[model samples]
Target: MRLTRCSGRSCLSWLSTIALTLLAGSTLTAGIALDLQDPNSIKAAASTCAYNLLTFYTGNNTGDVPGNLPAPYYWWEAGAMFGILIDYYYYTNDSQYNDLVTQGMLWQVGPDDDYMTPNQTKTEGNDDQGFWGMAAMSAAEQKYPDPPSGKPQWLALAQAVFNDQASRWDNQYCNGGLRWQIFTFNTGYDYKNSISNGCFFNLGARLALYTGNDTYAQWAEKTFNWTQAVSLMDQNYHFYDGAHTTLNCSDINRVQWTYNAGVFLLGASVMYNYVKCSNVEESDTRTDSLLSQTNGSALWLERVEGILNASSIFFATNPPNVMYEVACEPPNTCDTDNYSFKAYLARWLVASIKYAPFIQTTVMPWVQASATAAALQCSGGTNGQMCGMKWTQGSTWDGTQGVGQQMGALSVIQANLIDQVSVPVTNKTGGTSQGNAGAGGGGGVSTSDPALSQNAITQGSRAGAGVLTCLVLISVIGCSWWMIA
Candidate 1:
């Protein structure tokens, strides 16, 4: 049974709805759904959602996919939508969306390749660029076919974004971390946010593994350590929102977000695998020595496991083991930026399993149950296929449909497939086995520093490092069932 955290009117209304549906003898299986073990079924669901995204969100220009909020279009959500499409491409190995990815990303980068454009104003936040940068990195990781003819290589574009992000790093605040915004007047400019730092950390980890470069690895470790040092992430492995540099970086925000944890979780897994798979003994040089040190230390890997277990416990629910935001759920309090929170959580849960093979038994139940509920909520909207913002409320749509909603739903569906088919084949870089599109081109600046590398070591693991056995609850969400794989 689904347990909600809301009370009074909202809770009563939701309960009445659930009661009415049960009285009608109606189960949640109305539209198409997938079995978690069947790759074909997962692909079919993802393909339908992929088409739904293009149908509802695509504008006159492919790059003009609008955000749910005002400003008509925002780079961050658009970048997130792009990431969803990239997920579809990777999971299904379908090339149809390749052109869409190419056109959408290329149109946003200006002549300088810094992602600054007249259509885009006040959009220079490191996190904003990091969102699109992560998508570009995904494309690069998948080796999405190069843009037709004269376009920049996919990996090069990602590097340009990363170069710009690295330039935003400020040591003046909290020892070291990227500021939330580049412009002084923008809200949260002086305040660092988890998503900003998490995105940068994730990008650094991915680029390090992708390029086999020590410099990016150093940057990733540095970002991870800074967050830890500033108390942005606590002893319990719970990630807080951010801290204010203006207050001498005191006064922690203490707000935790699902996406923030999700990004860093995935990044940590990448770092773990990077250490695990690298040839640390290849040479006795400084880089090799550093890699060897990181590899021998299980600290990062253990932290990844801790965060996964903590997330499963803190974000718990019972509609067949569904995971909720805890903070935003039971009340439907999620705003525009929060709409896609659960998708990020689901994406990385599956990624951690696929890449590092670290604690699938702990993370898989959440993915399975959440994916089931997410699919059940998709059959009630106008098109008979739109997904809602809250998956825990019930099987009814919340009358919301946009890039955020579609993306949130589509990613959960895509990630669920990984558990069904098998772990995706990944290279030494801990990415899916795909050819590189090409190397990055412009905005190239080395992030390498001897002092930075020397100071990059992470703290040792703390308590609660024991493995968590996966929780399995076999119940019906729809007309589907599965054995834990």
Candidate 2:
């Protein structure tokens, strides 16, 4: 159903379409029929996409799991795929993919187990290492099942990656920022990119959260400030592509990607939750500033919230709510590398809601609408289902199948585990069931990161008058939840 502007009747029509989509059973694997609010449905959808990864990957042993892409494993994309699998472990607590995750990460560690120089090399940029490092850190945070006897522990691998990335922090260009490429021979070695620094900040925040280490928190703050100081991230929290050192690192790439926003948001959220003040002391005066504000409002919270609002508001102006590739997808010129961009957005959106529940009222509607459109845009593929790049309602798949599309759709579906809305219901006995109370909007409940515990709603309640601004943008029509196919 096409949106005819934001009128009440049009909102009702959209709700009707969503209602029809949800009535289709949650098990439908071909296209839609995915209940984004149900854990079982999320697990099924994630399993389907994860199983599909093997088709593109070539490896027999555990270490070779994320092996070379049939054409040599692209570091960034493959790293993200590894992360999706790890997130699945965290979301569902099913250790089925533990070995794969462990082996895949172990395979990347150098002889010293530090990822400074991974076994494989296309271009060993700080950004590339940071991607893999973030994945390893995610595993460490989860204590991912385990590889095998004598293998490096997930924590050790992550620390090694952090140690290596920190060593490359050059103060020459922008006081402190990691270069895009580490190898002098690489073309962009002199460029300081958002991904590199964002990865560093993310890794530091996660490490700080998991290990309770203040150094990691310090690194997180410093890296975020460097990105801001250097103008890689603007005041509105709009992240530019990269800045070159040739011009005193003053030239901005002017391109915006969702993943950049995702990483920084998740990183800041992590810091906000774990690091109360710059000093991780129990009696620090600065800690008072943290508890007084809302969740995710301390440290990098303000900036994180800024980026989240800016991205959702400005990224996709045409469809109003859908998040699009601002630089590439608009022109139908997004290449394979751009395919997986939205997946990161999906990942961090859920992360933001998890660590910073106060933002749930702000981000829930956008998440619901986008995830619904993604599921609706899926088409039957050789392996059950494939989602397209453009996720407008009722749009057909572009006949494209690769890691990017698979990851993008998988991330969105997986995020449902965290951001799902339950509608209020009445039982046969005339009692109101405390179920999810939303279809067009969320329950406005905020939960802690799944890494904390399986069931921990840190804070959840009705959106008060203060959130009217967020509520204004959401079309609340008393909609019902659905699992569309």
Candidate 3:
């Protein structure tokens, strides 16, 4: 999606074609051919992602949580991986990524990352523990067994990740809940963000379902109950900003982040399928009120749907030719100053939109490409536009920005998978909000903080790094019906 605008033509030639084919007053196509997947784009995005994940091993992973982007941190990247794999399948359903997942599963030892290691402390502060673990677990256990060879190695990785996260449940928070992390980005370094904790809980729920383990599911129930009581957002949503970060509770604001919010929904939807009465653990009678057998927590799913609904703003208001935004309704343009957030939000949002089509359906060619172009405009290379991100005013082209932009590459292709499914996820919604969302020019003003009023990132540094050029791993396996466990 972000790789090739002309398939093989040079960027200048391609840009010329764009100009000739599109005019300012010319209405953009409302519906794209659902078969919009591009093999070159898929390969490019997957390859770049491998490098981005590799950065997590070093101290280079950006944003606030420094050393916790890749392995040895968490599995919140399940959606991230889904973004990549969906692109792979859509473009050319290659089984090679599954091979990588299998290889990743085989290497699920401490040396591989932090698979065998326990949390340095009893709290869930172990960043990569659940993030990568969940992605690898889901791919290996459920997804990778498509060829029908019972994957013992993948099963073991899933089991191992479950064990490690479970060990962290000494479980005392500001209230009676599982303490996920004792750290914060804005202020002091000891608080848990709901995004991370929700990811952790969701991972646990996924593992329980994978192994058919009552203990794991029981634990998942407890965490969800705690989340409902504490992190429930806007009275109607299930997401939370943080457990309780600031005095005014303004810090833990709306459940706005797209990838972050998807964790909760994926967990609930996946967990809802398997949460039958099990005598796994009876330590406390406090049941996970959201997981029921006969009927799902209507409110819980509705909240999840509502959260996805907020994400559609990416499509509604933003220029159909632009990429994604960091916040759905950011106070100002600076909120999207971070390049990677712009990239991954679109990727993750697309993953949720497509996978949970009940939440969002329909394929808008112009909308999808707008996001890819905005991101490519940021990246700006033969692959994309090869531009850098606008992360703070002075700091330019850091590792964090690169990490985030790769997410866009991931989403551009992921959405291509379900593009053929013509029905809109919800007929009640339209892409009206995306009209003014992702405008060009880095950012001229700051809606949240005047301090974020940095100018836009220039197009010169749209330097595509070495990894962006080629991702060679690919084994085309026919897409068959699900080989359910």
Candidate 4:
């Protein structure tokens, strides 16, 4: 999301999210949702946190700014959309992520949706999935169980994504880059998009692997090469679409935002890895170049950090902690949704603490959610809500339909825990453990997010719900498959 500079063209719209709700008659075989006539704050409410989170997460709706809805409202749901789910799958060995993602895939309708069907409501060129699609394919392959897919729902979503891109047939411009915008709102049409092209490059590489089609892989490589050659400048600093030199457009290529450049770093790093996997010789070449490329990416991250640090300085002018000039966008085509900015930037800063070759450690542990319901609830808010909600524009912590900010923060924490062995985990006996082990470690496979929470109140009652959810999900999956078969 950025400042409004488009030409009144919006690809994704409110109707898109609502459309999925309209057409998706399918239910989660995991059955995390209940028809229960009443709400249980402790059991049901806690479950609501994960259930809604999983749903948004699975949709692969996080992180990379959607041109349509640019608010922090969906930030957590989107970041955890990929970053959290992938790490947790390996850390906790739980089915929650699967349920979240697979069910989400089934709910596709727009650009990032697994189901990328033609919609008259959408712009002609706005059909790419960006990083979200790449992450979804990765999650499905890594975590999905065998047979009947543990939930046959994913198949439809996957097919939809593939069809969406193939139908675009946008194999022109900067060598197969996706034609991102016919015209971004107040902003003019951003032709030859760098972000979505990189995503397609990644997806194409995966398709080449999964379908064993070298053509797609080659396309991925070529696109990557074009993007790199064209997009990179000033020793690998990223641009919105590509370098200004390679562009025919006037101003569109001139303006490069913090995240726009950072995404290229993220994209290049991931794409190079996939390219290497396709061949041993390529692997070695990529491995040799990986550090340099990652360094470039780190540089972009550093730049982003600089801007955020300055903004936080400005916000600090307030006695308490007021969000001023936070450099967030509104949920319009041109500007990003501001709510998402806070959510995403927070996670990005945390990520820098873990990765990024250049280390700048700033671990703000105070932000962690409280262990108890009362403690977790914001102090000043009435009837159980976050105090921050009052200050935060557009959206609340109490509303249970699901909050993107929570999903974003939760995903970042989960990813942090899973990536590192240092995060403490507990066991059934209620003792301390480490590196995804002991009684709380879910029988040693190590892929669940909930098991790693260090605090007692958060981790205390989750195991039962997790184990039951898994078993019931497995059963439902079996039955769902049998019925389909």
Best-performing candidate as measured by lDDT? 1
Total clashes, candidate 1? 1
Q: What is the C-alpha RMSD of each candidate to the true structure, in Å?
A: 8.4, 12.3, 16.8, 18.7
> What local lDDT does model 2 show for residue 357?
61
- State each model's CA lDDT, in order: 0.65, 0.62, 0.40, 0.33
- Model 4: runs farther than 4 Å from truth? 1-101, 109-114, 118-128, 145-176, 181-190, 205-217, 228-234, 241-247, 253-262, 272-338, 341-402, 420-485
Q: In candidate 4, what are the lDDT values of residues 440-460, reduced to their tens digit?
A: 111221122232122121222
Ranking by lDDT: 1, 2, 3, 4
TM-score of each: 0.80, 0.76, 0.56, 0.46
User: Judged by TM-score relative to the true structure, which candidate is superior, 2 or 4?
Assistant: 2
Across residues 1-485, which tens digit of lDDT does each residue of candidate 2 receive? Answer: 45456668778666545543443334234475677657787677677766675567665445554434545346666667788888877776677767766666667666766564444455777777777777766665544555565776665565666666666777676666888987788889889999989988887777555544444555677788889988998889999889888887788998888889889988877666553322223343343222333443343556667887777743343344566667776577888888888888887788666555667776655666566666655674764466777765344566667778777777777776774432111121122111111110112111221221122221131111011001111222121122221
- Model 2 misplacement above 4 A: 1-30, 61-66, 117-119, 277-299, 313-320, 393-395, 419-485
Worst 10-residue lDDT window for candidate 4 reads 467-476
lDDT for each residue of candidate 3 in 432-451, tens digit (9 for 90 to 100): 11111111121211222222
Q: Which sections of candidate 3 miss by over 4 Å?
A: 1-91, 95-108, 111-124, 145-152, 180-189, 244-255, 272-293, 297-300, 313-316, 320-323, 327-356, 362-401, 419-485
Q: Candidate 1, clashing residue pairs?
A: 156-440
